[model samples]
Target: APQIGPFSMSDGPANSGDMVSTSCSIVKGDFPVEILWLHNGEPIDQGNQDITITKINKHMSAISIESVAARHAGEYTCIAKNRAGNVSHSTSLTVN
Candidate 1:
C-alpha cells in the first residue's frame, strides 16, 4: 500500500493570520485509514481539524483540511490500516 498526505500548505494574508486549508488522500478498505495531522511535530486532534474521506474504490479514500492556520502548518499524514497491517505517509507545510 502507498500512503500520501499533507500535499502542501500555503500562507494566508500578508499582515494577518488566516486559515491554510490543505488536503490528502489514500486507499480505502474494510479497515480504517487514519488521516493524522501534525503541527510543529505534534499530532493534531480531530476536534481541531476535520478529516474527509470518500470511497474511491474497494481500496481508496480521500481527506481534506479546512480553515487551517499558521499553527496548523506542519507535517500531515494518512495511515492506512487493516487486518493485514498499516502504512503511513506525511508532508510538510509552510506559512510565510
Candidate 2:
C-alpha cells in the first residue's frame, strides 16, 4: 500500500495571476508509484499551458500554475497509487 506524507501548497488566498504550487510525497509505497492531480475532484489536464506537473523525486511530485485565474480556485488533491493501494491529500485555493 502507499502512504502519503507532507503534502504542501504555496501560501493561499492568492491574488489573481499569482503563481501557485502544491506537492505530495509518498513516505511509504511500492516502487513505481504513480501520482495524479485533481481539481474539485476532477482530473486535471496536464496539457494545459498554464499548469505544469513534475516529479521532484522518485517519491514526490509537484503541480504548479504559472498564473492563476478565478476558475482555478477550488479544492486540489494529490493521489498516490501503487500495486498495494492508494493514498491522497487535499488543499483548497481561494482567489481574491
Candidate 3:
C-alpha cells in the first residue's frame, strides 16, 4: 500500500505576487510512483508558466507557484499513485 505524508506549505499564508511551494512525501509505495498536483479540483500541467512541479526524490515532491495571484487561492491536492494503491493530501492556500 502507498502512504502519503501530510501536505505542507513552504511558507505560511501567501500574499499576492509571492512565490509559494507546497510539498508531500511518500513513505512506502511501488517504485516510480506517479505524482499529480491539482488546484481547485483541476489537474495542473507540469511546466505551466505560473506553476511547476519538482520531484525532490523518489519519495518527495513539490509544487511551486510563482507570483501567486488572487485566483491562486484555493484547495491544493497532491496525489500519489502506484500499482498497489493511491494516496492523497490536501491543503488550502490563502492569498492576502
Candidate 4:
C-alpha cells in the first residue's frame, strides 16, 4: 500500500539496449516522508534487488534503471508516509 504524505517516484522508459533513468515528484506532506518501492506487489529495494534510489529530496526523487531488460517490466509503487499522514502512487514500466 502506498503510504501517505509528500512523495512521488517514477522509473524512466525502458533503456532499449541502454540504461534508463526514472524521476519522481513530491507534493507536500504533513510530516517526514518514507519512500517504498514495490514491483508486482513485491518489495524492491537496495541490498535485495537490482533497484536503487539515486536521489531524494524534500519534494522529489529520481532513480536509475540498471541493466534494462524485458523481465524488468512491471508496476512500481511509491509510498510516502510519516507521523502526520501517508500517500502513494504508481507507474508502469515497459521494456521492448
- In terms of lDDT, the best-performing candidate is 2
Candidate 4 residue lDDT tens string, 8-88: 223455655557556555566554566666767887777744667754676556666667677767777776667766666
List model 2 lDDT by residue over 1-96, tens digit each.
888886556664988989999778888978889999898998887786877999899888889988998988889898998899888899898988
**Which digits, one per residue and each the tens of the lDDT, describe model 1 over residues 1-96?**
444533554443322254344555554444455444455556555554343344454344444445444554556555566565666666566544
- lDDT by residue (1-96, candidate 3, tens digit) is 578888665457788889898778898778879888889999998767888889898888888887998888888988889988788888999888
TM-score of each: 0.51, 0.90, 0.89, 0.71
C-alpha lDDT of residue 7 in model 1: 52
Candidate lDDT (C-alpha), each: 0.49, 0.85, 0.84, 0.62
Q: Which model scores highest in TM-score?
A: 2
User: Model 4 residue 87 lDDT?
Assistant: 68
Which stretch of 10 consecutive residues in model 2 shows the poorest summed lDDT?
3-12
Error of 1 at 74 (Å): 1.9
Model 3 stretches astray by more than 4 angstroms: 10-12
What is the alpha-carbon lDDT of model 3 when measured against the actual structure?
Answer: 0.84
Flag the better candidate by TM-score, 2 or 4.
2
The alpha-carbon lDDT assigned to residue 47 of candidate 2 equals 83
Candidate 4 local Cα displacement, residue 62, angstroms: 2.5
